[model samples]
Target: MSGIQYLVCLWILLITQSRFVRSDIQFIEKHEGDSVVFPCAIEQRNPAPFGVYLKRSWLVPNEILFMHTGEDFKMKYDHDKSRTIVSGDPINHTLNVTISELTTKDTDRYYCEFIVENPSSEDEHIPGKTEFFLLVTADTPASVDSGRIETCSGGSVVLPCLPAEEGLAVEGVSLKRQKGQEPVEVLYDSRRHHGNEPPSYSQFPAERFRLTSALGPGGITYNLTLQQLQPEDSALYSCQLLQRDRPDSHASLGRRALFVSVKGDDCSCSSSSTLLYALSSAVVVLLLTIVFVGICLCKLRPSVKPNRQAPIYEDMAGFKDLKSSTKLAPNHLEDTVSVYNNTSVKKSCPENHYESPTGALCPRNETQT
Candidate 1:
């Protein structure tokens, strides 16, 4: 009876020791638009996967982000379905989740819970939980030494303000401009909007200013991006962090003096790619024109030297010349003779001689008798 009681007590002690282990809280920081992996493991060697869940503190009521059964893994959130991936071999008893394209809102404490089928009882399972903290921050972190941002006019610049502490929750942020002696509130956001809508801005033009916050290794850092920058936009700027339920508790997170210089859109301001494209296009056109002209010259060269033939003359019977017996009359005498002959035939009938058909002399009628 004493040995039986001792064996039962030893079995109970072993079960309690196995269930009391807690995972260490891991601190991780990732840049926006990046990816991160959460690691989880069960103390039981080669534990059978019954069910697994991942939850967050900010997501109240239904905080489950992902779940896994012995068959497959599934996600409860709409956005998580696309970006979440469960990667780990079940044989290794590791439950690892990888999430891609991390945003500022992804910064939170994540808890991973695993359920295994109970060995002692049928239709029952035991659960264990572990936690990890993730901080999603921007690629460009704010510097504490100097707060100065430089940009050209008509462009945009992000004024950075990173908190010095780590894992601190951000309640609200306000951006201010200090010019001369007075400070003007450029934008103020309380982070209390619905449907994932961004925070609201104050008196300043809402379109020109945007509020951005990210989780960093230090803490929650807020930033502001000024759009359509102008020379007048250059001034001393500062961003303050507000405590929850304490509107007056405006803590100075960072200060940045913006220097926006006028950017002229002149010929020299053209991008290198545009200039290179223009030059390449011009060169291609010039080469094409030269090739076309060369082809035309090659095609026309054969026609330049024309084929020639010698002239031919043919004689006619009437144009044959015959030798004349009488002396040839001069051009002036021939003209006078032609005029005299033409007068002899006019109006008066000559009694001496009638003109022959060839315009030569002929005998009169009395001589013929």
Candidate 2:
């Protein structure tokens, strides 16, 4: 056959054998191994299509996981093939996905599209289109609502996870540490024993760590305490909802990655220091408040008050006694002073010492003192 005939035949073969459809995870929920349905509507939600193919590309990670284009491609990505199972007859166009084992390295923006016909060399060949973001969180010091991660070589590290919302009856909790390709389970709890639940406990993954339930102010808080942490413990930690059905971690809600710089043999945290700092801050604030109050008092002046020592010299009130030789008394007057001078004044020179009219001494006899 001529090259042209051969090329045309190959195109026809791929397009015919390989069907295409669309798929994508709904919701913006970001996590690893989250099952998101990639819709492959046959005719924009009408009748499902007859041909379907699943192809996904991760831009940030720069990896392409396309459907096996050929037998060689299938062999290279066989695991992916088994992991990916489709539902709904292609003739009807519906697909569901279940990615079991998820990793932190799965952080990437994904696009899943289908081809109506391969090598169509035409516009109608493109099938369905959808995309999703998978933020594969690390499994290190895991918590539902991860707060902060701090680590020292042989010291202590605390990983706090905050749940999406409060009031979730977390039945059990588990913490897993992933180093290289190996995941070491550090903490496990069989029963949270919240409300009226009974307590359950066990041992696994040696004795590096243990999970315990404690009644905290934060409400039945679950904790995984590790003593004498090892250097190899440094890894991406994750907290998973403890479940027995699949006996596998559900989805990780929180994560943190940290490097430990071990120094000597001291691996314990200094809660005392934190407390001391807090106490000192409180004391300083209290002192400042007291000082502020004192300053305000000092700056505020008092209004002037009437003096009790001042004599009450008021004018005589109305309806005074005007006849008697006695002076009139005021009804409300506290005190009265009307003094009468005994010494009398004489004219400059009483004329020739006029006969005394019960009064004057002549100036001739009077001396100006």
lDDT of 1 by residue, 92-185 (tens): 4567888899875676567766655667766333333456656554434553233345465677877775433434556667676643333566
* Each model's lDDT: 0.55, 0.44
> What's the lDDT for residue 30 in model 1?
66
RMSD of 2: 26.4
Clashes of each: 2, 24
The clash number for model 1 is 2
**How many pairs in model 2 have backbone atoms within 3 A of each other, for residues 3 or more apart or on separate chains, i.e. clashes?**
24
Q: What is the TM-score of each candidate against the true structure?
A: 0.34, 0.27
Q: Which parts of model 2 are misplaced by more than 4 Å? A: 1-39, 45-50, 59-76, 117-129, 140-369
Cα-lDDT of candidate 1: 0.55
Clashing pairs in 1: 165-218, 166-218
